[model samples]
Target: MAFQSKQSMTEPRDRTGAVQGIEGVLLANRDRIVRFLEVRGAGDGAEDLFQDLWMRLTDRRSGPIADPLPYIMRAANNLMLDRYRSARQRELRDKAWGEASATHAPSSETSLISREQLALVETAIAATGERPARIFRCFRVDGLSQRDIASKMGVSLSTVEADLRKVYAALAVIRRQFDAS
Candidate 1:
């Protein structure tokens, strides 16, 4: 007789497999998620929120999520709200007094670079041709995947991807120019 462990069934399909799957999902959606937050002034913590969302998704405490996409958006939004509250406090301090009185410290150079990268992304998004720009905004800014964007726009996923490629190419050009300058 073969013995099967009870824990095996609920163990994330396989530890490495789950991690890989989650990583892939994050990579596929990360740029768009960060860009979405960036345009909304949450750019400073976009990557952090992205990481946090992935963490929440992978957390055993939450158990299995029925729908990961909606869950991710909700998590992202909540994290963004928390970040906004903290930022607002800093802003108030800076406004009432000055940088000297500000208790909240600024983040590191890497974080600043991330924000700059997001800015370049936005510039590129804006520069894209009309339909592409709209599609990119729907996907990147709204935190909707290509499938969701396509469905909402009444287009195909391939069309959404084509739009993204154009936007990405424009962003590359913008990033290069920004780097040089």
Candidate 2:
């Protein structure tokens, strides 16, 4: 469904008194609801979650909530929690698939190609010099940030960047060799 901007989703109000329904209360506090989602670590998905919240409220046949604000907030929180749980479940499932794949043997041709690629990469890294090789491993394999790599290596940020560039250049040469072969 199309999501409206906060300004476009006008507050639910009749002329008589307080906004009565959950949908009305949510429309009135859309910005605040989004903020609540953000605070709960929805991050970039906060707007989508807010829209989902709106849809759920509209689709359900609920009576007017006496305290719509708190009710809406609780609903938003529950939505975020559900999203988080679903994401986590997805991650675990993917991880399981990956682990299972690691136990399988490749075909002879695939195995040969993988070994050749690994040898080429090792050779390239070695030819790039010790400092650059170490820096590349630290950043890529160890998952260290550039700043962290520099700090750990007792080198300047520029040095870490330069080393990474050198590693990239070496890899390019290796790639060319592979293409020629």
| Poorest 10 consecutive residues by lDDT, candidate 2 | 1-10
Model 1 agreement with the true structure over 119-147: per-residue lDDT tens digits: 76776687787789999888777878888
lDDT of 2 by residue, 1-181 (tens): 0122232245423312332355567878989999999999988888998889888766654433556677778888888877776665565456547778764333223122347688889888988999999999998898899999999999999999999999999888887776465
Q: What lDDT does candidate 2 reach at residue 50?
A: 89
Q: Report the lDDT of model 2 for residue 131.
A: 96
lDDT of each: 0.67, 0.74
- The TM-score obtained by model 2 is 0.43
